[model samples]
Target: MLTDTRNSRYAKLCGTGGKDVRWTNGFWRDAVASCAKSMVPQLEHMFEAKEISHVVENFRICAGEAEGDFDGTFFGDGDFYKWMESELYSAVLLKDPERFQRLRAYISLIGKAQQPDGYLSTKQIIAAMHGESARNKDINEFEVYNMGHLFTSACLYKRMTGEDSFLDIARKAAGYLANLYDQAEKTGNVQTAVCPSHYMGLIELYRTTGDESYLELAEKSIRLRDSVVDGMDDNQDRIPLKEHKKIIGHAVRATYLYAGVADLYAEKGDPDYLRVLHDVWHNMVSTKMYITGGIGALYNGTSPYGNFFKDQKIHQAFGYEYQLPNVTAYNETCASIGLVMWAYRMFLVEPRAEYMDILERAMLNTNLAAVSLDGKRYFYENMLRRAKKLEYELIWPLTRSEYILSYCCPPNLARVIMESAEYAYAVSEDSVYTGMYGENQAHFHLANGADFVMTQTTDYPYDGNIRLQISDIKKDGPVTLMLRIPGWAERAEVTCHGRTETYGKESAGSYLPVALSSLEDAEIVLSIPMKTRNTIANPMVEEDTAQIAIERGPLVFCMEQPDVETESLDQIWLDPSAEYQLRFEQIDGRRIGVLETTAFQRKIWNGNPETDPEGASNLYRTLPKAEFEPVDARMVPYFAWDNRGVGEMRIWMPYRTR
Candidate 1:
């Protein structure tokens, strides 16, 4: 029995109870504003100006056909329903009340276009009701995929607006899908046909509306997915989540499937689902995931097939691997967005700070980097590092001309940014969890009439000093406020009402709590220690096994070729600790730190007499520990790579040993 009261800790964190925290507030505001200003225009440009109209229009036409008559229809250019769902989520979650009117108009039009028998897909309506031969020819093109996205969009709209009209449409559409897959007596097939994207929508519908039928459908969908799991990985054609355990098939589909499974686990609290989720998560994190938390090993099919790392020839220039060939390494932005979406679902289930940690990293680094700073232009594919000017192409399957047209990333990002508030605050019965640090406030209700307020103040990501103040403690009982010690925090110090207490040890992903009871207007201050440290990646990566990356706090640092102003940045070395100095300076109105260190120049090999194997050459095995003269070097956040016109960037660097 959750009440819409403001005194509860959950309420405060959710912003339902008038509590303000810096991290949650800042992130919510920034995300909302960015999505509105950037994503909206892009989405519109795709529909209004770009070549994606055909695909989008075709999807609408097919949906119309499906709804009009019982017979399915396919208009053209494959199924675009998944893209529509992504757009819907982006619109509903991000725009919310502002976009409500437009959404209502669109939904109303859809309802009006519906059929009499509760079936509501444009494709079916066109083919079955109108008996249009042209539209009915390819009706089965992407039926499951389309149904999945439609379901997702409907659920998202209903949850955000609490409107039942959209829900009605959703119910009708779902009923159609359920009959097609679940109603064996009606469809004359015992087999269940499911699309990965639908699971997210169905699970969400169940969660919000508490529909047991939706849950049952979700379970059936999961079973269907399990049935096809083996087909996805048969040929070693996908990216291995572990050694010889590859996660294969279409990138978007694979992540969506995982997302559906995660949602099912959340709804049913099934231990098997949880175990499978863990298996998938572990596999992805260990191998399939990029440093920025993106997945999708192949660029061509946007598929997660093949061992690209082992076969260097399979690695593509754009981080896109079409059939494991190196010519195209286009890491699709949509795939990245999909990864973020899936990871966010994981966060909801586990409520771990790490999931959000990766989410933040992906958003700041890869997600934001996808589009230009101006927001008008966008890149569907993001390379590991930007090289030459890659033109935007309108190739089908791989490329679409719309900025937001059935092109999933734009709208997906929009929705995520809009609903960013939901991610900030998660509540347990006794305490509220703070995942990311930004400036924001929340309000929620408690069972009791007493009201509570929590406020946070800090400039984080740049600095680690956070101050949280609580006001209006209703009851004289012990209350707990949990502050996540980011995986990057080396040292954490907490001050309760000016009484400073230090937590001796710190780790990357853990939480620190401060207890308060009947204390009004009390403040808690957290000071995080930052220092430069050397780190080595997992030994599995071959070339850089001995190399070290510089890190400070939760950020991983990289050295770019431009920073050294050299054709090859292989000669730089860390000088002695005393000699190297870290300096903060303003670049293009942005404040960034630079680390200066000494390096030995590489000697030319002219068949020299001094070709000593043991002698100290230009290539140093270990970096000097002692102080030396400083050299100019720019340092960027590990997450912010590739945003500033990519050059050769290396997180791990070779250094001369002393």
Candidate 2:
């Protein structure tokens, strides 16, 4: 059995209590509010559309308001539960009394929806009543998936509120699942479930209740991925997980599975699991992921779907190895979140800087890009390139809009951003490692049982300067503070008590550890210079061959039609050796970082009859030097693109050879 203990070599949270952390930076605070503003209306619409009401009505059918059959998909209940989780976070952050009361009311309704046997699925209840054939006993129904979210939300709610009402409901639901699985196992007829998110939820339950059964169930779920009945490769159940080297199938499902695998490794200390995980992570980050930390390259490429079918209509799944297409990329918002989830879990296990680097990359570029600036609009599928007046819609099943039918990404992204405080700082025995940087206040305890409060101030992503102040330190020994030196940062510096330590290339991808004995008015300053530079992709990437993308600090920059005077995106080409000026401009009352540089317009090649002289087209003939005209151009953070109305956007641009 894996032990449930902290990593003695690294910093870990002393307990499951909420870190006394709050964002002091207006940039993040405003972004959080923007996401909340977007989420509240979505929640309201879901409420009005009978999304939440369906769950409430299902409970009433046995007794009160709703009757007959259930509405929406079998997996629809997970959406509502996720929304509730996001709303709960928003309520706490904004201190909105009215929103808090309304969510609590919905919690009560959900509680009333549970059955006597701890069964709490509205779809199943309604299906049984209507005599409709729902998903077979063959692990097809998304019941486990829904219950996983419920368990997670319940755990989060309990941690935040110290209230056990929701936790009690979650415990009951998990008990029912445990009993069902145990009975099936005893009969030698276990159903093979596809989604592994429940594995994560079960782990959370183990963390919450110290129950060995939940951990056992989580391990069983991972092993069950090899079970054959009705499972598909798209769900990542094609083979035993230990043998698979590449991350395949649905991007979100694969990430969720690996996340649970990571959690299990942390608790159980399973070396085989860790070995497989590192292999999968290297395969993903090195080849499958996008420059923007996006995944799920193609919805229906020539990848195996089920046991035997190839490209049998799979959505949001990774495509063949390097088949990345900019315009047709299916980088779903949920997949981006899943990427962060997987990376953060890996960081918890090893406390590596690259893990946090990926986490930050996903948060700033792909995930933040999913939501509009006002937070009212959303993008379900993030495209790397957009054409002008192309009448092109997202090739995925959904269209890009302020609202979506699936409605999963909006709330999910909102909640992830709102809870950014939790990821900023992590602590263990005698140290606190700063995984993410932002203006925030966090209270943490050292492994020696000493408590301290820290305030971090920074304009990160926009500016790389960070200052941390420690107060209220009660300690017997010196505590270590580890600051992550992002992989992209060069010439990073950390100053303490007028003593400065500089990190060169060797220390670029690791943490800078500093030990301090006295905590009376101690301050640490870190500076990572933010300079604009051209980044080139690996030559194996045919789409990006001989192309360059602009990057500054932690953000990947892109060219939007609004920022260029040229008519089309393809007409613009940047000089590889030109100097770039970095500055900020006001957009929607916010300062958006923009990079200005000298570029050229690709002069159209009209038939040069005079040069040809033969009045006939020739395959091999010397032509007049291609005419080029210099032009001034600007680029914005990739996340900030598409905000100034829809227009052409491109990240990889043609480089001028001259």
Candidate 3:
């Protein structure tokens, strides 16, 4: 089970494939295969070297296996844990034997580094080695955030391997949190959460061990927010979560907070919480988010605050309604991934296709785009468009780097990639849901406790045809399967057992139920035409007014300066009557879908309209109409644009209807 939400009342989680499903071939398979060969070793080497990361160094120093002070970033421990999770997932996916040995060593180190009281923040442990008490430490140190990841990774270890060596360490750390929360409840000095992921981690721990006290601790963490003083929008602690409505402030924190609340709500089923989540989600998707499924439009922003508050600036933030900027957009890799996490949780609670749509949108585009096709380099912030000149400066520069100073997004994305199969398909005790189309063989247990072997064959995101065959059915009567017709698909047709059924656009953005009476040796074929179409943004979105974007299948297309034969992007315009061609181009050893079309490039104005003279440049001057020249333009999938070399890139282009 991907999330272990099988017992969750509302969630339709990955009910099948618990370290048993095999990914034969597809985007996710390629990613995991590449991750094992490229990313895992590179990241492992860096994390192990003290001069490079200090992640393992701090743990070793605290465990007395090495000598060093705490030199890692505030979130380095959490990132290390993320890498650990990635390795674990990849190992299981590929059946690599060496990974288990590495995991044993790492687990031993973690258990040794933990203090006897179950306290395990390496920063604090190393500090205590130098006689520095953890008390009075700044909340910004993210000690809770670090230990929270420990709980999740530790639980994953136990769930996947049935081993408690690491889980026991997490139990100790969780025990420390129980006492910490108890004392804070008495003292009223609640530690404010920074980039809070602990909420979901605690809930996962509770789910893994079936412990009610861990669940209580998860709720206590949220209740403690009520006592936080001088809270700001950056951390989402200004008011209690119940009263919070608008989703503003740091994008990563906002999404993580929502996901954690969702985990808590899955068990408790709070209606008010659901309402607030829906409202905020509407605000985000309707106003702030990009069409490519990227979140957090602004690299820096001013959150709502009074004069009494000090420094209300938020980083990697979501700006005001319809304030989406293209060239300077800062859709952090982790922020979009966080959106995916939130969307999955929201889908669990309501079982809506809109949430799943966004989940697929973000996961396939920005989330995959975060790292290179080879899975080595990474982008911290994804921009929709970039040119030689930037009118707005970015705090974190936009470019793919081998390893950034923060080093969070690379491993963060690796874990998502390793776990991509979890999002591919979902199952229940009665039926199976085709959430995403990919080529893989899966084992599922349905009603009557019967296990069946199902194989899905498709080249999705580039093609719309999918085939699913079921065999080895022990017991069956009226087998049912649910199909998720995407919000973007105009219509879909499914043929199974010589029966053909067509669904219109009315069924879009929701699930369609198909009942198969003859269940044994059943074969289902789903065909949805992959038509290339020009899409437009809302009229109120100023950056995209009168502009068009290209989309085919589930992939958004962009025109890189290197791909198109145009002198300038702003002067490049698309013809409504233009015919498009689909071509497969080789990129970084991967075949990518490239769209080729004919367009016009307008020449620069030669003279001022009123003056009738050349070189009379003015910001607001009226200029003579420019001449146009026909140009052959080619567009690549938006995710594959930056991989070709750093240059100008454009997602939206000006278009003329006539």
Best by lDDT: 3
lDDT of 1 by residue, 1-658 (tens): 1111122121122222112222344423554565566666566545433244443343355444322223212322113333333344445434455456656665676676655555554554556546664421332245445556666666655644567887787778677766655554444433323225667767656655667798788777556432322233322223322233335544565566677766666556667556766775666666555554445545444223434444333221112222221113355666666667677667656767777787776665566556543444455655443222235642422222234333555655555454555555555555667766666654423333334666667655556787776666655335667777777666688888768877755545777777766447677888887767676556664544566667665455677666664444544554324233466654433445555555443332222327734333445555443332335566565444444554566665665545
lDDT by residue (1-658, candidate 2, tens digit) is 0112354222144322343777776567667776677666565575446554454455456343566666655666666777777777777777888887887777787787777777776777676667865533535567787788888888778777778888888889888887877766666555555555677788887877777888898887677556555445677765777887788887888888898888888778878888999998998888888999999988765444344444445568787666677888889889999888888888877888999899989988999888777676788888888866444665453335755666667767877887766678666677888877778888776667768788888888788999999887775447788889888887788999999988886887799988878676789999998877789987777888889988888899999988877768777898989888888887765677789888888765433535645433455666545568889899999888877877889999999767
Query: Candidate 2: which pairs clash?
Result: 2-268, 12-427, 12-428, 377-402, 429-447
Put the candidates in lDDT order, highest first: 3, 2, 1
Q: Please give, for residues 357-408, the per-residue lDDT of candidate 3 as tens digits.
A: 8998898888887888877888898889987565566666667888788888
Model 2: runs farther than 4 Å from truth? 1-19, 51-63, 133-140, 187-192, 304-313, 389-399, 474-477, 605-625
Best prediction by TM-score: 3
- Number of clashes in every candidate structure? 71, 5, 0
Whichever of 2 and 3 has more TM-score, that candidate is: 3
TM-score for all predictions? 0.74, 0.91, 0.96
TM value for model 1: 0.74
The residue-level lDDT of candidate 2 at 299 comes to 70
